[model samples]
Target: MLSLAGWSVLIQASLAAIPSYVMQCAYLPGKILDGVDRVNRNFLWGSSDSAKKVNWVGWDKVTKSKEERGLRLHSAKGRNIALLAKLNWRFQIESEALWVKVLKMKYSIKRGRDIFNKGSRWLVGKDSGLNVWHSNWTNGGSLRKLIHGPITQEASFLEVKDIMLDTGWDWGKIPFEISLEIKRMIQAIPVTILSRGAGKLIWAGSPQGTFDLRSAYRLAMGNNMVFNKKNRNSSLALEIVRQALEYYHCVASPRLQTCKVLKGIRWERLPQGWMKLNTDGSANGNPGLAGCGGVIRNDAGQWVVGFSKCIDITSSFVAELWGLREGLILCCNLYITSLEIELDAKVIVDILNKPAYVNNIISPILDDCRLLASRIPQIRVKHCFRQANRCADSLARMSVSLDSVFSSFHSSPVDLLDVFEDDFNGVNVNKLCPEPDVPL
Candidate 1:
């Protein structure tokens, strides 16, 4: 007896409760999916399955954003894969854990040594754990295979740091005759003698030096591209089935309530006589190809100007700072007096606001941003929700494929027009807020 809107909310609530990791591992049977799809159709039409097909748009369109001409419902399969990819990502990046060790030992025992051996290499930190000869430190194979150095049995287990010097590698101390190839390989190894602790393993073919589900899913989908073409409407069908199953699951948790914090906020215009700037940044991978984008608007919420810049391989954090710096520079050139800058990244705002010195790789970029901000008159930088910064987000994403290092737009891009209109209209965007914790 529930209305379509009521059913939709109920279904979403059910979905929110189920842990995404469970769905990632357990592939639901086809029969279960059929029953779920049947229920979704029922709730969507508010009628039985005997009735004519009520679905107008396909499911593929449903999962896309409003800008993409879709309803913005996430695909169950896509979500599952995305979640599961996180597990694989953690396994590669994180330090050894009980669970990780267990999984590794389990697979290695069943598959044998060749299973884990893929010519992968590790960056030496303190070089305490690495074995000089047995470990795969050299480019092609173990160093022992290349040069069987004459040494006492006790020295056979020598670590990589044993030959390290304060300045650089001490290649002369080794007893074996160093070949040209071995010497080249030794020089190529990025061993930091000052660094403390065990070295970290690097996953080959990962551009960001870390694992990502988006990358994993892209690879998985590529293999199934032929299958996808066969059923171009597969997304459409999957959406229907997903909704039905969600509704059935909702019946088990009627008491659950959806949070309303996100729906309550809307994009607001700047104060009179002040310009508003919204900035965003994106990277293909954490330290991969990145881009910075920003949009400046007048008091009336009309776009004054926008910018997109393709930055070389850099972290997303640096990209965000660059976006703000670029926006400030443009505003200064335009002779804007009072300004308000908004960004979706809270971490960047925190780092800038603090007085402490940043001694890391990003210290120079952070200092540049701070210096630029000081020159701007009556400027205030604040954090806003990503939902409200759609135009800037879109521009940043577009910068990824741009050939030019920098580009500026006097007017809004065609693809961002809808999002711009939505912001101007003060449309309420749905964002799921975390539920309040209740003591049992």
Candidate 2:
């Protein structure tokens, strides 16, 4: 009987044989073993001088010999070991092939240069026929064509890593060098896609997709970069498109389309003997406890008239309409010809400018203001900002606290001339509105 140590050694040898045997069998058609044999023969006995040396037939014979020997050497005690070894060998071979393909593709730009330029004599010059009398013909046209456009350098790994970080990717655990390389690979693909305008088609097809890319680009470039401005505007345009898409899809909020409508006339002054009127409204809560305000400032910075009132209304829209009405009534009462009016509400402005009327709630009031404004000679209505007219906002806020006092004065035109006159003449207030018409 064999000793235990000797038996163990035999078992180990047998186990190692199975995988090598399987690989030899599987790769027979590919002639993998034939290549190995040639290498082995060259190493051991030197290459044969024969032109038609050992080829695929010789490799097939070697593989067959190895497989037969492996099968005969297999034993029940080593079955699991043999199976595992074969599996490992197969996996390793697959992994190596995949890695080789990846490396080749990754460096294709540099490696493919020769293949791309194979037929171009302009790129690869020919040897002269005679050394002394060399006739060198130039292919300048082909060379110029090949070199068209600027040659852009690839982004550095560090630059790519910085871009990835700006996009909110966390790659801190990866080694700096590895992370940078990976980032460069990822960004390079998108940059190429974007430059070709192919990326726009992809983004346009999906809702909000364009906006997301624009935002991503902005984030990558950073706020300080000039591209950020361009990207941010692009993002806004995309957002508008996305909003429209949502509406078309029936996913938009109803309130998004609803805008405040005003009922007041705007007033202003023209250089050629005319007064301009403007009306505006403000509401802290929609359809509830709203405020209406209007201002009538002439071209001379003199306040002809202005009023702000808090009404127990349901929406800001109503308050806005009320402001228009108040301004129109004031203008009509003042009998100011050549009236110009302004408001900050775009919807209200549109309504007044166009003959068509919408929004039943404010239509009647808007009509009333329109009729009154029409009665005046050369009446005009325009939009102005909340900041442009502080007097109006202050009055609106004050109306909330003094609702009872203003409502009581509806029957009579409360004189605000003295109050404004005193305030305008005040030392502290005068500096700011030094020449009230001269905007700061």
Candidate 3:
């Protein structure tokens, strides 16, 4: 006999997948979804044809996450809409895709595009291409529609660049009389330009300026969704369900085996012809004192050059880029043609690899990294585990204590010699891996 947790796993793995494939592209009928939900409830409660059991908590409650005191089994209807929203997001962003192009040619494709546009805006560059009045750069609509009165044709033709300065909004250059509130509103909006590429449209909801299904679905469904159940002893019933859920975790499906396994992680040397660069960044707190450090080593793991710089208060991401930027600059100065770059942070490596995905704040340093990288004929960017880049990580941590300055080391730093020696000797660092599950 399967426990409640076992049933939860069985339903999630085998039963729930039945409708998910079709639900993404097409909407299933209400009857079909209801039928599926009925089956799931029956199966979950161990209801048989001979003996039907009463559903203590509502099906809606069961579909909610653990935080909400539920099993986190997705409702077919909600899952369908979220999945379709993802497709709609992809259609807008990936216009060049063959599927999107074909759909565009065959159908008008205007279903959710308008709704998505309402929540999105232009990631402004130099402000030349975008019109001061006509561009879809503001929160909801264009400046022309947002403003109450109509202006002269010549005045209306003004572009964003005409009223923008290097520092901020050029008040004197603004031709028409705008209210103080409107001026402040325009000034608050960031109009940033990168070294390469023009302004791109991005979803305003996400920090990365990309459309995510979770955020989209949350926005679509409304953020504050409360599930209210009208049943006697609801709190007592939920406690019973929780106890049932935890009943089998130790003895049933989780079936844990405790065995010590050695996860040997070591700093890898580059190819004979290529030099490896390991860079890392550290901060006392995210927005507190930040710094970066990096080291360049040959094929035999012998350090050629290294640097440590203590940057004042900044984000960890910026600190990471600073280390990479300094390393690239060093490589350029030394004319190191063949290079392999390694960093513990994977996102920075991704941004470096995909230049089209630009964030205005990081563009300046990212542009520098790109430009410096372009100088080198052969270059490879890779992500390494934090354990593998211990030497560089230690250097980065050390920079936090030093005064704000860029210091270069011809040889290994005195404090970092132990880790450096371990790395050079190809010594493996001991890491305890999670114990495997013991089968009954």
TM-score of 2: 0.33
- Which segments of model 1 are wrong by more than 4 Å? 1-262, 435-440
Sort the predicted structures by lDDT, highest score first: 3, 1, 2
lDDT per prediction? 0.65, 0.41, 0.74
Quickly count the clashes in candidate 2: 33
Candidate 3 residue-wise lDDT at 265: 83
Question: Which candidate achieves the best TM-score against the true structure?
Answer: 3
Better of 1 and 3 by lDDT: 3
By TM-score rank, best first, the candidates go 3, 1, 2
Name the best candidate (by lDDT): 3
Question: Once all C-alphas are superposed, what RMSD does model 2 give against the true structure?
Answer: 31.5
Which lDDT tens digits does candidate 3 get at residues 1-440?
Answer: 88888998999898887887886676678898788888888999978789999888899788866656788776766666666666677786787989999987886644344445555667555645678788777543587776787777877777776776654567776567777556644643444322423466676666666765555544444432321111234367777877888996655777656687888889988778799999999877655567789999998888899999876565688789888988898898899989999998999889888969766445556776888899999999999889899988988888867754678899998899999999998889988877677899
* Comparison by lDDT, 1 against 2, better one: 1
lDDT of 1 by residue, 24-69 (tens): 5454555654455445545555556466656766655554544344
Query: Where in model 2 is the C-alpha error above 4 Å?
Result: 1-269, 403-440
